[model samples]
Target: MSSPEHKQKIWKMIKDIKVGMLVTLDNGVPRARPMHLVQDEYDGTLWFFTRRSAEKVFETAGDQDVCLSFSDQEEGVYVSLSGKADLTDDRELIEKYWNPFIAAWFHDGKDDPDVALLEIKVQMGEHWKAKESKTFQLYEIAKANVKKDATPNLGENEKFGG
Candidate 1:
């Protein structure tokens, strides 16, 4: 079982880093590409816009298992999400998450025949977020290096599930 607070924290980090690498298995090899996360709410699911003819759609069709990796370097936050990706032609969802940025990709707009949605039902996730400033982190690392018996305090690492 997971706590609501953990879920909220994970969602907050994900929202903060809107773009993530979506990884899918292509012929038993991992293939990844940067994708924009469009969903506003985190309810054990994430959404992305793609074209029907996209290679990712075909890849997911073969193997639903996928991973989404997010990183906010300035904030020192990194997250990995494991889930199953499904491709859909849901017009309702397309319209709900539509924006001008997305319009640039879909030249024909939401009604474009190629418009498609990639939905990932997240099953588990892990995140590492720095609890201290970079300078402090460097100081801790230096201290640890000098004191071989000490362990460097870096950040919070948590794993949660839906």
Candidate 2:
């Protein structure tokens, strides 16, 4: 409906943004992969079901900082969340979200010793619009020709008639 309402919905979508792309660094670059995940409403924690032996799991083994992104087709919106990812070899959760399809990956079994879960806690995020009919080029154009201005630091204009 309105701009604020749209933004609100984008924020709320985190609750249903089932799958998010996890971006990690290999050798000081970027790598993107998709993952099905659950979301925490109050504190914005993203839960993902994955295998402990997966490449992603290994990448985060030494690093906790990461980026989680979620988007949907219903609306032209997307959210890129930057946060820390904690890897746990928890067997219980591994069996919880396991399905028959996953048997292909874990020959050892769904509750195999290598299966695990990745818990990502979001810190701060940026939301953007993605249109199917037309690419999101508005921000790109404005951003390209954008002008920079310097402003006074905070509290500079906070003197209350003293």
Cα-based lDDT at residue 12, candidate 2: 76
Provide the global lDDT of candidate 2 against the true structure: 0.63
Q: What does candidate 2's lDDT look like per residue over 78-117, in tens digits?
A: 7777778888766665666567666666688865666777
Candidate 1 per-residue lDDT, tens place, 25-110, comes to: 88999999999988787877889999999999999999999999999989999999999999888888988999988999888889
What is the number of backbone collisions in each predicted candidate, taken in the order shown? Answer: 0, 0
Q: lDDT score, residue 55, model 2?
A: 82
Point to the candidate with the largest TM-score. Answer: 1
TM-score of each: 0.94, 0.63
Deviating ranges (above 4 Å) for candidate 2: 1-11, 15-17, 38-42, 99-107, 129-162
Residue 49 error for model 2, in Å? 2.0
